[model samples]
Target: MKKLYNIALCYQGITEDKSKVSNYITYIEDFKAQIKYIINLGYRLVFPKEFYNWYKNNNFLKQDICMIRFEGGLKSIMPAIVWLIENKLFFGISIIASREKSGVPEEGYLSWDELNGILGSGFCEIISHSYNLKNFDLAKQGNNIISVPVLELPAYFDNGLNLYLKGDSVPYFDRTIVESAKAFPIIGTDINTNNLIKSSIQFITPKSFDGVLLRLWACLAYPVSTGYNAQIRVSINQEEVYSGDFNAISYPGNIQWPEMEFVTINFNKEFYFEQGKKYNIEFETLNIGNSSFRVYAINNGDNNIILKTSFLNGDNLDGLVPCIIIGDGSGSSWTLEQYSNYVNRDCEQFRGATNKYLKYKKDITQYAYPYGAYLANKDGNSISSVLTDVLSKNGFLGGFTVYPSRIYDNRESEYIIPSIAVYGNRSNDIILNNISAYIGQLFEEIDLKNIIWQGILGYDEEDFVESNKLNIIGVTKIENYKKKYKSQLLFKDIDLEEVRNQDLSVIVNGYDGININCNTNADLNYIVDLSNMFKRYRKKLELTINIKIFDTQMTNFSFINFFNILNNCFLFNFKVINNNKNNFSNSVDSLIKIVNNICTTKEKQKIMISYNTDSIFNQSNNISELSLNEAIIKAIQLGVKIQSDNIDYFYTANNISCFMNTSNGLNKLSNKIKQNGLGGISLY
Candidate 1:
């Protein structure tokens, strides 16, 4: 049985009542009592740093320890120091102060001078209670001013005063400046009563700790009173090993109730613990009041068990394995002398070995064994193609090779095994080719049972039939035919011709059309011109006008010249089939010239022209066949007749041409005719 050492008694809720003077005195008395109790338990009071170092280096006997704390500011100063010094008690004393309004202060709830005196006494260690007892900064607006000394307060006051005197109101004090001051080397705010008591007990009474002679199996602490019910759960390496509970109680008429108590639950089960891993024990309160808890542990049992387990479990294996090579060079073009030298060099570089060339030859002659050879390359070609060929020819099992690049690029590296060549870049075609050649050479030397070739292609081209034709397997970027030919199409000459025609039609119909109308001007002088027309001999019926004009002369005339001629013509009947202004009369002659010049095998013209339907007699005629010059002249003649009697007309032609062929030929032609018709011709 291990001798138990009671270390500390963790406490909570000491300074609560600010209005009751006696409550403050009672809290101070309870603080002193806790110190006396630990000393009686035969445990020396130790600072956190001291205890931590000792626990780490020495074996702690199984004993109870105590860590005492109070909540809120000091209702009364702590007397633990005077009591311990006078009585010479053999227990550890730690005072955790809760900075909360209802928690304790670490420096015995004393003034700065008083705290320093306690520190000078060397009987106690002071943890922190946040400067503000009520934690005002973290709370809603309150009357309590936080007492934590702000390191930058002086500087802030200076700046704020300057600004205030300059007619500027100062904003709230800077939080950053306060936080920086607190973080300064000597300005760390002590843990408030809440954290101090919680952390102290949790430190000494760890649910589990490890050392040479002792090991803590399990521990649980809880208040022993009603009203406040708190439970702490502890575990080692994620295993729920221990738990305990504490309850709060009320003391009738006794301000120093001593109602707070704890219970430690321990597990006797044996477990092998390892070092340098995280272990945790958590405390959760079922009911709110105030409480403190701690956990402790010792070292015992065989430490070597963990190390042995690690070794037997095979947790240290990684990296590549070495391979042996065997082969002969009789069937290969390269002589045994050259091949052996190459094998030896590669083997040494890769930290490998191969059978002796001379001894191998002897073995082959004596026992009818086959030749053994090895080849190495960084490119995948040697192993993928060349080795397969060589082994098949020689009728012997070939040695393995590796492709470094394939492995690096996460390609099919396994294919390089049990073959002619080794590592190489799979992405480079040259590397692949070299691997193929190397395997081919190997096959010539040895008669392999069956040869397998591995080839890689692009992802999109993975299904490429060509890659399969070369005895290669697996998809890669360059080998997938679908990807290789994604943007390409195959078509016959007839299909292309059809497409060309369709394109031409779209341009003719989808675009606007130009209309030109020719009319005769009979007015002599602006006044009484009707008298001159009345004197004319009988109006000529069926006027037979012989108009001889060159294609260029009619179509190439400027807009002014063309319209002028139409104004001068007598009873001209011409109609345009399209209305696009870009193709107006000015370029009609140039268009005709271009059409006549297009002398393809199919005898097709490519000129785009439009005419007005109102200028022609028949608006529903397909005039695509009309020459450019004829189209313009006919339109002019129709325009003149329509103007004289207000009667609509149309034009007709065949084999008309347009620029480029498209898929909308019929619609384009219809639009051209409609645009140039007398009054937008009906489909009929």
Candidate 2:
């Protein structure tokens, strides 16, 4: 009897994974280098199907072969797999057979065409890793039950009742074909079982609109991890609308954090909104496994935009790739604990596998057998949940509370700071002050604080500023400054430690405008250079950026470039000002939408919902107060919170327009903001 010695050592990403983004394939190059090194040790490469074929034909290993198993997905991992297939060596391959077949294909999963491409070569054969690649978790939210998705797939469509895609719906993971799994292959056995399972799709139309309805969508969830195919059918008013495969995956047990994804259906025709009309949507599921899913959430009304289309590209490979060992006669009855031995033993299969090819290498592989086999605990009693943790272990004090005292009389004014004075270079300086004074007068008539700012707005023509320069002289008591400036100016105290070359470092917030122009470019490089040269001597200098939508000069290429470069760079409480008054409410709405399109939900924190009150809200105390209703005010506040974890409402005491002058308008706005969950407000 001839003895067989074939070693297949694999390091799967899903086994020892490290990534921040759930659905992104991050360190593939690093993994490729290490895996290829092991293969060059004179061992042959084999895949799942090849292994099964060998077990059927060769019975036991008689030749030197190394098998490489990869999880299934189309374009998400095509580039790397394509490169491997083009290699001269014969290698085995595999993918998760569970993918969308009926409804619109979910983004990032393997498509049929990509799978065919993988199987196109005689050297490769794909094995079934799983059927419904999900580890289901169902929990009751009060009385209703909800389940997180099996795979960590970030979605694009944000659907809700009375909400839909407002514009032309964008398609992603488009024009891709994928293979559907017919049956599941059990591990450690040659048995294959054909399964037929069923599920459902739930769809909702947001509102009645006379315009063209762009998109219809529903979320899909898979509970079983079998490698069987699933399909879904959708209908509106009992009429079949879409019937296709569920965009499911295999071996969902490998995913660390899974997110449910929405399947998109394009409805490009106009539809009428019914005040009392009911639209019925139905979803039917067909599967070979006992796998099931839940589709919820009904949306209608206005549409929304999902930016950052590249997420659909699939460069970020997610999902799990399993590793199984065969060949030995005792491999069949391996216990659950013994599987770890297979993981450890295969890692030891490194014998003649490393020879002259290893001559160029100086480093040795660190053996940590069975690494990352344990389940991680990121939810349920995490570190963030600990409340009674120690804070002072140094033996100073415990069980005590203290705060800084504002009653301190010691004043430190020995430092020689430069004086602040305005250099009236522009003829618009005096006119600017007059406009500011009038706005202040208007605020005085209202019940709110009379304080505003001259946000440093940029211009196209040689950096035209709305106000003059800010020359700092010295520091004084906060109350003294309030007495001196009255309701004319409001400014935030900034830390000047990071400021270097600038001549003026410190300036009191005069509650007035202090606009400046950088007649230069708006590129990131330009901003860096400007910061390096003209440093502001303050920390937490949240500059209020100006937006002039209709101003042709404001649309200068440079100004637009600054914004284009930093699309998602706004803080939660980001400050922006608009001087337009003609369409005050509409202007605010549009600006909020812009912020929504540019930022991600996670990135939105501590947002500031500000109303510049320039010329738009400039009305009599009573009139401006009544212009907007309670619902509108609450909507403004809710909008900010929807896009951010934290939010606040800010209104300038004075601006180009004295809209705050409306007697109770600003006060009512403040109250409504609080009612709608705005965190804080700036008092003039």
Candidate 3:
């Protein structure tokens, strides 16, 4: 067994309050307990090569630990991560998965050198947190009129048709801060969160029509724990016609951008109207608690309704940059060159600040740990999404984590991890064919090898979904899609290279590993069928299966058949989640029981304890989960594997102070690994 162990996490969350420099150094020294400390190379560039030399000279890093997270884009953090690899202070880098041409801000990603350098590090492993396109903040969202060009002004609406308005009288909910969204000043009436607000407008119809389409652009005033459904009433010419409710997303903090939606009020058929008819429009919504919504009127007179709600689009505010942190007073209008200059200057300012802080720092000297690229995404970025192909071409990507509904089998990767994401996964449940089709869409052109096809069933969200907070509140209905992989193999895309290259040396793969909460006869049949298929393609594809049948519900399968089936597959990974984990402990009797029943000589090497979705601080639960470092030591003793030894799933900065600079805060994460030995750990 490997001797060394430690908890892994980025130090971004660590914060120290008002304290003397000496106390701060002592706090930093407490981190010496972590077997491996993954440092964040945020705006400040810590050239690992130079830092590594200094540490080595000072007898630092006598033990193996400390991976670096190049948090932003490669151009910003590459020099540091690469320098670490060159100096032999090699460790894995976390990667953000980039989906599209990248979010507009190119400064937030890594380059080929930084990626290649992490790959070159012999002691490193790259775990992509998740793929993201960073789809927010690109387009301007506001009143429809403001989105239209100035040349297209004076637009009008008659009956249901939009026409040019010669003159019109309408009122606006808010208009002064119209173009800006960052400053959300939605106008409305409120008296201690209990007030009803009404709005009205008058228009002259240019032509007659049977019925008219009315669109309302508005936003909610309050953030809540749950969604709020506002009761709204609409009237035409002071006559009530429609009343209904629409669900509004919670803002959580009673704060939001200025964006509003175009809600339509469509009649079943046209309500007859004559040409040049005068009409009045009135609208009101019930305000419950601190929930109120803001509505913005477009400059145009048209109020046409649509079949569905549409987002209002506006031009990018004239001279604003996302990262430059432009204050309200700063005027807008940035050329590409100007934005780039701001980014460069911002980086230098941060770097300079970091140098001044680190000078003569005692805790900075206690333990200097260098990390590879850290991949989870925030600030509108997924750094690893675009790096997938790069890693695969270099033969470094080890596995893929994808939805069970969507198969992402990377032929070059050593493993493929699947998870369930259907809180209400989708309104529709996918069939086996749909699963196969989704798989083909992703792995169409990749070459295949003796790849062991391993898949994970549903588990707790972010450790399975995104962010520990459950995006979906219920179990996915993929139960039908569950325990059904073998029948879908016929649909596996044929890897032409694998066909031509395999005739000389045939490799074998283990049978399928079907993970579930509780084992079922149906799942057993699925596993056995996969076993037989592998037997036929034994020479062509050495497929190994990893069954995780004990996350939520334990299997009651007869040990005789389960033993044979478990042996048939190469590995079995299991997980369970607690919404509230304040009471979790490392030494759970149930975990021991599961290991006793599942761990066999043949499966010992294949067994992997998931190193994802764990709370660094203690939690409350009957079967409290183990902290990363505790689990690593326990896994070694029990003879199993742990994935993502570093912190892999965290969202929000709420718990940052807990890990920042308190003497008892982050040091609790270092654990015994620092005092005992050093080793390697991996996580999904």
Candidate 4:
């Protein structure tokens, strides 16, 4: 026993003249022919509903069962139902009817009673196409033209309705007649040529079924109009399928009669059509006025063939090529990963099947997997849900968030906070911002200041210098400057012997004075050692540093070198002292001047500076109270403020005083500087 699959043959019937053949004769002929073809092919025909139920239960014999669907009007389907029941061919069938004319009183041919009688027989099922096949396109183009009642009005100038002095009732046949008829409800009246013209026109053709195979298919028809000398031409596959002209002939008395004439063209020949192949249908019209046209192609056939062909040919699903999937973790739930995998898998399956059944040879290309794990959480809770929800609200996808689990320690649970992760793609920033806004809504109670953020500071490729050269230049120049000024400085020639010989016990008793007296050579040496230690301490307190290469041009190589220098400087806890001197007001002045100069230079735009508290506390207001080393650091921070061209180059200072106090104790407290109110970076 071969497994049988159910197949449904769907067909639609349309009339160029619905009034002339208002019964089901035309549809019955086509349906009977379709049924006979299926039976001849050794398949049993069954109704659609029964076939569905049978397939759901037993999966139907793959090659033995088929179903037929006749889609059109009730008038066209009623006769087929009678024929099926009378013949005792209790096979399954479904009827789809146009809802618009179904309830109309059938004229002499088939009344509404007869139509219902056939449907009540239960031989066929009825499906609605639509309440009315609305043609908004025609209504929009018609622009308030009235329809007339041409069929009911008399033909001559009799007592019924008259037009003019010529004793002709032609005025009754004008637009007014059609408009007046349209005003009345069309319940039981007979549809005439004029009525059909007023309503929307639907064109049908044999090639309509080719939509299953062709990438492009269209229908063309000239709508009803009062225009003179109008024609419509249509062609399929470069061959003319339809062409016709319309004209309103005027009788002798300077009077006009409104009439509608129509012609239809259909492609009857079979042509090998394939998916993704370019197909063209051209429409041309001339000598028409104030008229509109519409074309529609109804497709009902086996589309699996086209889908399969496209799959085998590697014509990506709907023309979207698969791309790489980035980020970590399982790709199961990621839509991007899933979509890409589906395409790749389909291609692979197609290749395997082709090799076995069609002997076709093809190589499967591998796609690259994405990098990084989608951080599930940066803190304790899953941030994925929050991030995803935020992205959805903002109408964007593909934004990333740093997972709490990836970066934070469980011990720091209280401080664990998710920071919005931004990708390298600039196009996704707005979406990420929206996501940030959404996350803000959920954690409204938490202080944003407690959260820590990580961001990359991109360097300008051109401004970067080689690390070795930059270090050599900066060190050599500073050394040279120091050598040139060493003798002229005030502190260089101070006599140590005389000061060390004097007693210093009295000064030691006070908290404000220097603790060691320098009266002897040993005491002087001690003082110098203490100053050196303080210098080292100040170096450690410098949080931000900048280097300027005057002669160097910014380039990729230069930036690489600059970054290397920055990393080394940060590691060694040393600040690069700027040697620029012309702009100095005090020790702090020299640093500030250099900072301002660097900020103004376009080549050094990527340089960044962060504040260290020791340096910030040594500004001019507190300089008198600071030791020599403390003043140096305070000058550095002030210099940064003076020279910074934009706030983007500044990094916020982190308070590490608590850690310092715990590690070093009271001796460290003596040197602590108080922070004065200074406005930092603006958050907004």
Q: Quick one: best lDDT, which candidate?
A: 3
When 2 and 3 are scored with TM-score, the better candidate is 3
- The stretch of ten residues in a row with the least summed lDDT in candidate 3 is 321-330
How does each model score on TM-score? Answer: 0.18, 0.22, 0.32, 0.21
Query: Of the pair 1 and 3, which is ahead by lDDT?
Result: 3
Local distance difference test, per candidate? 0.25, 0.29, 0.30, 0.26
lDDT string for model 4 (516-576, tens) is 2122113322433433443443321111222222112233234344333333221111122
Better by lDDT, candidate 2 or 1: 2
Error of 4 at 269 (Å): 41
RMSD of 1: 41.6
* lDDT, residue 462, candidate 4: 10
Off by over 4 Å in 4: 1-5, 13-31, 54-58, 77-79, 90-103, 106-112, 133-684
lDDT of 1 by residue, 1-684 (tens): 112222222222233243332312334344454354335544455543343333334444333333232222242434444555566432222221222112222433444444445555555443322122111011111331121211101111111001001222321221211221110000001122232121100111112233211111111122212133445443434454445554333332111112111121343243333334332333223223332332111111212111111112112212211010011101112333433433233223212111211111111100000111123233524433333333333332222121111111222322232211111111123222322222121011111112111122333122222211222222222222122322242211112223234533332232221111212322112112221222242221111111223232435444444333333322222222233333433343443343345323222111123222211123344324332223323322222111111111122323222221111221233343233321111110
The digit string of per-residue lDDT tens for model 3 on 1-684 reads: 111111122321111221311211112222222212222211112333322333334332223232333222334334434444554554334343331122232344554344444555553444333222111111111332222211111222222433222232321211221223321112232434345545444555556665544434433233312234556676767677666754554231222322343334554234555677776656676545344444432233244311111112222222221111101111223233432333233234333332343222211111111112222223323323333333343333333222132111111112222221111111112211121121221011211122222333333212222211111223222222213434534222222234334532232323232222222212544444444554455422222222234331235555566455445543343322222222112322354455555555445444433323344332232334443223222322222222221222121222221111111111222232122221111122
Cα lDDT tens digits, model 2, 1-684, are 111123232222221233421222324554455346445434566653343344324453444444444433334455456667777544433233334343334565665555555656654543322233322222222332233231111112222232322343322211111122111111111112223322122223344434222222122323322223445555545666556654544221132111232223333233343444555444444444443332222222312211111112111212211011001111112233333332222223221222212222222211111110111124522111111121111111111001110101121111100111111121223322322221121122222223221222222110111111100012111122223433454444333322223333444234232222222222334443434333342222232233342233334445354343233222122223433333444554564565466544433232334443222233233223212112122222211110111121223322211222132333444454343443222222
- Candidate 2: residue 505 Cα off by (Å): 99
